[model samples]
Target chain A: MCIVCGCGHAEAGTGEPEHDHGHKHHHSHGSRLDFGGGPAGVSLPGLDQARILRIETDVLAENDLIAAHNRAYLSEHGILALNLVSSPGSGKTTLLVRTIADLKDRFPIAVIEGDQQTSLDTERICATGVPALQINTGKGCHLDAHMIDHALTTLAPGQGSLLLIENVGNLVCPAGFDLGEAHKVVILSVTEGEDKPLKYPNMFAAADLMILTKTDLLPYLRFDADRCIDYARRVNPKIGILRLSSETGHGLAAWYDWIEARRIPVSQQED
Target chain B: MHEMSLTNGILRILEDQARTRNFSRVRTVWLEIGTLSHVDPEAIRFCFESTSKGTIAEEACLVILEPAGQAWCLDCSQSVTVTRRGDPCPICGGFMLHVTGGEELRITELEVE
Candidate 1:
């Protein structure tokens, strides 16, 4: 009760300064509990010295869940899903066209091309007569599960299909999210520098395999092959490295063999 | 970055939790970003704010905790704490280090009013 107002109670009322609502939650024991603010005058009970996690793990966890769904879906259908990541103009589409041209008769290949705009990459793949769908990311830089889920419906059903999900040309964000690909392939051109792996370690670290594209231009560029492999190994020693050039038809056979090896069903694959 | 989708995920969780508990508003959201996760905290903040727009997590204070990374050293035969994944094992200067932990991104707690 204020001395000026002369009310019946002391320091008590609805939080609103108004006529009584007739009901008040009392400090039954006359003790008030303090929420945590103690760390910076913001400490809560039972959290004073304990390791408190203020994490919203919803994003990555959700992605993992979706990735699991994608993996199971693709595996069940006998689809070999590959997520291709690289810097722009690292010959992703050109390489795909060449690979499809060579292997079109042996396997049913499909391409889900992701780009910020334009259906150019999809058109390139269509030339090979393989089923291809363009995923215009609008302004988005990475491909996620929902996009692939929708693209699978629009494109050939990936069941029993070799699906190549060419992600929007980026070295970063695509490495973080799994688009349900059976394996992640990071393509790098000889001109992109051997230090590219060091600068973007996460990409190299996450990749199941790394392809050094444009190996035909190796003589013209002053790129060191040994140093490039070293950088990638520093980040991820487990990633398989293949050097290839679509123009020279070099390393294409190895690339095909690598893809085939990973696709062998676990039931048949020798442990 | 992919903040909008992350915001959507958070909102979905918040809505689901609120529905079962009869909560109206989320006062705060606690987030953990691992050291090796490579997501920008400032970017997440900006993305969360922009993506939230009238969702359960809208304008909720985003609290971030940086988790320490752990790696298994081939030479040491034991796990060692490190700053980031893919870092050399602190115990043994071996290149064959396997990451054991610290790639955490999660929602551990929430404050509701």
Candidate 2:
């Protein structure tokens, strides 16, 4: 006898697992439980009335709160945080590696690599001689703002530095979770479908810039670049578009310039 | 998919509410999910059943409310009803429709002790 529905039994378990204390407990999967519905007829008194409380709470409020904190923290510290999202095998990691190697000398750079299992991407990022942190989300599909807040404590991206967060190569889930980044950069390779923007409109709509990656492969593939851009604009008309090839170092300067243009100045922040 | 995580978020909100509202258990949860929110109601229910187990929201009945997607058509200068994200504006048949509503994903009410 459940309090609300009276259809199933209620099992006693720990309510609200402990929060992620810090980076020390990174891999712990909190609140992820696997329990079948218990047998019926577990009743608690005074709960039978089942008063309906008008809560009206947004489900993603917690994530959004932490994201706001992350954004404020980064802005106060003069760090330009960029979240890179794309499907797996979109050459996001390769573009990041190239971007780091090119800009590391000009500015202090840090990378946060997110994946479901191994730290392979983080290893590649660190090989570029830039500080990088690996966040293994385990069974999680996207990285939330709380994880980024914790990673920031360890990575400690210095003032006037660039912090590139490579999200767990996902176009669908990452669009809904804001990690307090200044902007979300979505990458779509030529090898992927040209209608990707139409298929994943949420991701395309949420992004500030759509990077058409692997342009060098365009000669070999039959990817319709114009139609892809058109579809992306259909979802988000103001979204900036850039075509770049990390293998050939083409159009990266313009990408760098775009980043520079969006970077918030330190002096302007004091106001 | 991401519904599992979203369920966890809902559970967290429930737990927090239970502590503050002095409720020991939850019976039903009325969730308002919008058509353009990119969340499937059936998928959320399935994940809710699994994620709610053993918590204050265990065995809770999930009632979902889907609001029709609404967008402001830039070309037509009027609000249009949209069933999906990429659907063209019904009146002007234009793609320059900016979404105005139907993106809500919130727990509107909770039946609790």
Candidate 3:
């Protein structure tokens, strides 16, 4: 397992042996049996008194530090960075493809695709003739600040450009990690349950915008758009709600307007 | 699922402390996980054991302190206890509750040698 993110890299577990940071040490002692036993089963013995150090450190401090640096870097470059998060099969990539095609002429758009194993999403984004970088996180669930910092170096989006970071298809973990995006846009497909916001409140609460995608399927399916928005509002009253369908181009204009509203004006970009 | 990454975070902290504090082995780790932090204590324990293997914190005792979620009810204008993130304010039954506390994930103290 990679110690940084605990990614097992279950598939194609070859040629990356150096990434595996953990050592497979088979100790006979169990976790339950090792409590306050005076370190009897410790691998390193002959230690003195157990010093109680009052550290009180935040676990995500390192990631947050890197994320701060990324935010500053993006702000200095006048890049409108958006971190797109959603569950699997939410048509996030399709939405990105459509968004890119719609605004590519007006703005220099780039993408950073994150997934556990394949470069498929990156390839799909690159088909739009935009520079895209694929970050295979292996078993890592979400993209962290450090990963985004590294991706920024390679996929260097132009000044005053839009950087769309498509996070891995998981709603939970991505909510916690700040990828230095100006706003987090979370997508909830209408095909899914309406009570998803209640089930995944953290993700809903963390998002600046809650995009209700696949609205074209709403008529065919028994999905309540109002109730879903209400549920999302229950978690985050200030969250902006947008209903769009990438397939039929429904509500795409409003989505485009929303993006344009957040963009820094060309005149201000010089500042 | 994300606990694996969190365990890695803990491991990094332990490694840093070992170098600065001059400790070769970690005996116990006291973690303060809040209810709204979205991290399961059991899953963290399991992941920590696996990720900390061959590290300075291998076989270390993990003492997790889970604090209950607390929120400020906008309707009632009072502080209330909440166990879950989406749960309404217990007193007023209002969903307009702003989270006030219990979202911490920190390593409070460590027993090292």
TM-score of each: 0.82, 0.85, 0.85
Error of 3 at A101 (Å): 1.0
For model 2, the superposed segments whose C-alpha errors exceed 4 Å read A1-50, A269-271
Q: Among these predicted structures, which one has the highest DockQ?
A: 2
Off by over 4 Å in 1: A1-57, A265-271
- Cα lDDT, model 2, residue A19: 22
Query: In order, what lDDT does every prediction score?
Result: 0.74, 0.83, 0.83
Q: After superposition, how far is residue B79 of candidate 3 from its true place, in Å?
A: 1.9
RMSD of 2: 11.9
In every candidate, how many clashes are there? 22, 3, 0
Q: How close is candidate 3 to the true structure, as a TM-score?
A: 0.85
Ten contiguous residues with the weakest lDDT in model 1 chain A:
A21-30
lDDT of 2 by residue, A29-65 (tens): 2254332232211222344333757677889999999
lDDT of 3 by residue, A1-271 (tens): 2111123222332333322212121122223222233332212234343476657788999999999999999988889999999999999999999999999999899999999998999999999999999999998999999999999999889999999999999989999899899999999999899999999989998899999999988879999999999889888877999999999999999999999999888888755
RMSD for all candidates, in order, please: 11.8, 11.9, 11.8
lDDT of 1 by residue, B1-113 (tens): 56556666767777877787666777767666667776767778887888777887677877765556667777788877777544676766666877765666667666665
Better of 1 and 2 by TM-score: 2
Candidate 3 residue pairs in backbone clash: none
Order candidates by lDDT, high to low: 2, 3, 1
Worst 10 residues of 2 chain A by lDDT: A19-28
* Higher-scoring candidate on DockQ, 1 or 2: 2
